[model samples]
Target: MADLTMARLHEAMTVLYAISLVFYFIDYLNKDAKAHRIAFWLVSIVWVMQSVFLGLYITETHRFPILSLFEGIYFYAWLLVTISILLHCLYRVDLPVFFLNVIGFIFISIHTFAPNQIAQSPVGDSLISELLIIHITFAILSYVAFSLSFVFSTLYLILYNVLKKKKWTKQWTRLPSLDQAQKGMSSALLTGIPFLLISLILGLQWGFASFDHFSIFDAKIIGSFISLLIYCLILFGYRKGKLHTTMYAWTQVYAFLIIIINFFLGSRLSSFHFWN
Candidate 1:
């Protein structure tokens, strides 16, 4: 029961942390004071929650939580969150604080979703189920990020066409500026790529651990990997001055279609994933 409660608390803290990152990203883009304030408070809450957990661990284990790999990851993530909050409060460095939390989020996700380390569970079999849960959760979050980027990209194209045609409708007045849309689309992609990469890694690890006849060339696995690579390529191209304006928007649209297909068709084609 205690473990279960801790698990739920860990999950809740991660969700809060992710939301705070979103706000921080907004503040990073536009320097919105309200957004910055909200982010700071949310991060503060997460830090407090982490501190409570650490306290509980110390009380129960009678030692600091840096003695094992699992405990070490939790401590590391906690330290990052602590430092990130301090940076936000002391220096008001938006970009550095945002990135610090992102790294912290990744490590926290790993620690939260990691398999039980109890002596009762065999070491090899421990990863079979919990890692799958982590893989699916991370993958879904990545899709959510991608979906948001798709909306921003779509808006960019709409605004671009409207401007090209010179149809200055009041309805179009509320749309974000072209630069804003572009930045938002890029930010979403940046947030998503690391998540998808982590999901792929955890998924592959789960596959190897869970299956007797696992193939690295499995259809779903390949499709997901390809999706990650394409997004990386798109981001790389944009950063290199190769894609922008209509071209950049169109690229994201096409890449999103690949994700859609990979999600539905790839699942059906995979021999084990369908059953799993």
Candidate 2:
């Protein structure tokens, strides 16, 4: 019951943090003080919640939460929130605070989703150690970025079709302009690419280091690389004028489909990608 309660609390905190990120993004683009103020207060609430959790953890465990990988991740995230809050209040550095909270949110997500049970055997523990956890976190985060890209691209396509058809509605009017959608998609792809590349590198390294029977030709491995390639090519095509607005948006939609397939079917087909 306690664990379940804690889990719910953590989920709530994450949701608030995500909403804060949306406001921060708005402030980043528009320099809206109201949005910034909302983000600051939201983050401040998150920090207080995290601090309470940390206190409870220390009270129960009688030690600082740095001894285990899970505890270490939580503490790291807490430190990031702390720093972001200090920066927001003291230095007024909006960009750094936004980014710091992003990283913090990622780490908190890692801690939240990771399984709570420790393995009984040494091999079992080793298989699910820090390296594996970090690899999975990076991969998931990359997918998150790609999913954002897909959303914006999908929006772009919808807007293009509506405009092309000369159809105007109140709902359509609320949507950002085509150029803004294009920029959002491009920005998400730019963020996703580096994250996906790094994740692949780290995942491969973890696999090779941990598994004696690891195969580079694993389905997940192949699929991940293919997804990365397709995204990169789409970006290149757009930048080089080989792909126009509609075409580029279409490619992103198709590429995102590939990602969905790879994430699910490829996981089932892979030999040792056990974190499914």
Candidate 3:
């Protein structure tokens, strides 16, 4: 019964988010302040409801609700919403808010509605050391930041193409300028790479401490190293004026794809990181 109630709350939150997204779209298309205001209030209401649900979940479970993959995804979505709200209030970054909410809603909805693949081996307290917890947290955060960078980079590419063709659509006018998008992409990468490096370092430490035997050849570890190297090259290339802007953006896209694949498939290839 409690589970049913929580599921209902999750659905309600998703519905509210959908409505808010629609209002944001309307505002963006029509330049209507009323719609924008409505969207803001709706998001606030959804945030409040999600907070209540999270509180109830934590109280009932007696644990932070981010241990398992499913819970972590949901919590990440909540963090995005929180960040979006803060950006809205402090910076008035409505365009980023729109993109953030779209991604957040998709993730939260998936966690709420999809079958739980990690259920059989849910990340129990016994399996989670302090170092492991910190590693996972920072890794997830770094991925989130990288995902945002990819979004901005993709936008930059699209805008670049539109400008190259001398075609100015409403989207071109509504979207952030090319320079703004490039700056945003760079800022997100700069913020994320440090967290990724720290996560990798802590992950190695945790692996060494927890496992009776550890190997650097593990699929996840190898993928993480590759990801780090790719980003490092991107930074170096950009700084040295060796990488074209379009190439840099596409490289970020490719790197993010590698990240997604490794995150989802690495456990299947190695026992050390297996969830089930």
Candidate 4:
């Protein structure tokens, strides 16, 4: 019965994600305001179910899920979507937070139905080691938060470009004003930098603790550092008043791409990081 319940709960999470994706798509087309409102409500529902899914995963696994590229993409996607939604609500901007969620849904959807993928790792309700648990817990949360903020940076760039070319229309008109977008991105980066710093710090600490070697130079670390460098530049730009919205947004896309690279082909998936 417990097994069945977990399975059902997982299924519901997948369905909720599908609903979020659909709503995001409808919003993208600028089809109907009524539909957009409905989409908003659907996103709220998905958020709740998404939380439940995460709660169950943590309770069952007793650790963070930063294992594979698939998990990274999806986890980061959730973070990005939530931040986008928050910014959307706070600024009443037309940023496409929903579109990113749709993208994340498609990325994670494959695994949702793949029991083989989900079943490969089985923990028999035993307590996970304290060190491993702590390592994974802090790492995944910080990384996920940074990932979401990264997405916001990307959106800011897009809106900036449209504004740069002086191409405003009903399609893109709903985006935040340039001033708001600039400030919003700065705020996000400000928040993300601290998380990135923490992840890096914790990662270094883990390396020294586990391998007795300092400076692992693993793919994940290198990628993360590169992403960090870019983010630092973005911050510098902001301070120097050189960070325009489009550039900052592009920085986000670039960072996310690097994250994808690190997740799939980089060291973050190594046994050091663990990816099946």
Candidate 4 residue spans exceeding 4 A from truth: 1-12, 61-91, 113-138, 141-150, 164-166, 212-215, 241-245, 268-271
Highest TM-score, which number? 3
Candidate order (TM-score): 3, 4, 2, 1
After superposition, the stretches of candidate 3 with alpha carbons farther than 4 Å from their true spots are: 120-122, 169-171, 274-276
Residue-level lDDT tens digits of model 4 in 95-149: 5466456555665566466555543332223323455445444555555544555
If both were scored by TM-score, which would come out higher, candidate 2 or candidate 3? 3
Residue-level error in angstroms, candidate 3, position 139? 0.7
For model 2, the run of ten residues with the poorest summed lDDT: 118-127
Q: List TM-score per model, in order.
A: 0.55, 0.60, 0.91, 0.75
Candidate 1: RMSD to truth? 9.5
- Name the top lDDT candidate: 3
Compared with the true structure, model 2 gives a TM-score of: 0.60
In TM-score terms, candidate 3 sits at 0.91
Which parts of model 1 are misplaced by more than 4 Å? 1-128
Per-residue lDDT over 142-217 for candidate 1, one digit per residue giving the tens place of the 0 to 100 score: 8756765776787789889999999876546546689877987898899889999998999888878777888989
- For model 1 the local lDDT of residue 30 reads 67
Weakest 10 consecutive residues of candidate 1 by summed lDDT: 118-127
User: In candidate 2, which residue ranges exceed 4 Å CA deviation?
Assistant: 3-124
